[model samples]
Target: MPKEQLREAAEGLARQLERQHGVRSSWEGDCVRIKGAGVDGELSFAGGVVDVSVRLGLLASPFKGMLQAEVQRYLDEHVS
Candidate 1:
């Protein structure tokens, strides 16, 4: 995808996360850094690829797979 489109998708994802999950996100260089409750992560888009790195707290670790799947679903629906 083009850079502008990717940026828009990232921003939309951030808004969805904040509204639905209470995860706050901010741009850090070319990546979006997110944190809230029991989660911390960074998302980067480059060369038409989206990369996600998440760190779940002890209380949230059990839901790691679920979270990843949700993110992947979001990307599949909106980022391509």
Candidate 2:
């Protein structure tokens, strides 16, 4: 996706999640795409298995991780 699109998606995800708990943290994101990801990767996941297909571009990994963590922290603070 385009950078603007990805940022919008990330913000949208945050807004959707925040609605239930009123989280106020902002969201930031970069363009991400997976290489060599076949159709199988698009399929359903197996038990106890993770399927990370995002490939970051330009933005740092830690930045993304922090954004995710902040989201989770807000959830934990407000919900769990």
Candidate 3:
């Protein structure tokens, strides 16, 4: 996707995360750094690719794969 579209998608995702999961995000250069009760991560968009790295607390780790899959699904539905 184009850079502007990517930016819009990123912002939209951030808003959804905050609203639905109580997660918060801040821009750090080209990345969106995410933090919440049990998660910390960064979402970066570059070269038409989106990279996400998440670290979940012990209590939340068990759902890591599910979270990743959901995020991928959201991106697939919204960012393309």
Candidate 4:
């Protein structure tokens, strides 16, 4: 994806996270930093590649697979 499209996708994902998971996110330079009761992460886009790094607290660990799937689904929907 181009930088603009990546940024748009990032913003949309941020909104979805906040609305559905109560997480908050903000742009930190070229990435989106996300935080919530049991999650902390950054979503970065560069060289037409998108990367997501997440740290799930103990309370959130059990949902890891689900979270990954959701992120993948969201990216698939928007990045193409």
- Model 2: per-residue Cα lDDT over 22-61, one tens digit each: 4343322232222221111111123322123333345345
Which one is best on lDDT? 4
Model 3 ranges with Cα > 4 A deviation: none
Q: Return the lDDT, model 3, position 44.
A: 92
RMSD for each of the candidates: 1.2, 13.2, 1.3, 0.8
lDDT against the true structure, per candidate, is 0.87, 0.37, 0.86, 0.93
lDDT of 2 at 40: 11
lDDT of 3 at 5: 88
Which digits, one per residue and each the tens of the lDDT, describe model 4 over residues 1-80? 58998999999999999998999998987899999989999999977789999999999999899989999999999998
**What is the C-alpha lDDT profile of model 1 across 1-80, one tens digit per residue?**
89888888888888887898799999986799999999999889877778889999999899888888888888889876
Task: Report how far off residue 41 is in candidate 1 (Å).
Answer: 0.2
Clashing pairs in 3: none
Positional deviation of 7 in candidate 1, in angstroms?
0.9
TM-score of candidate 2 versus the correct structure, residues matched by position: 0.32
Clash totals, every prediction: 0, 0, 0, 0
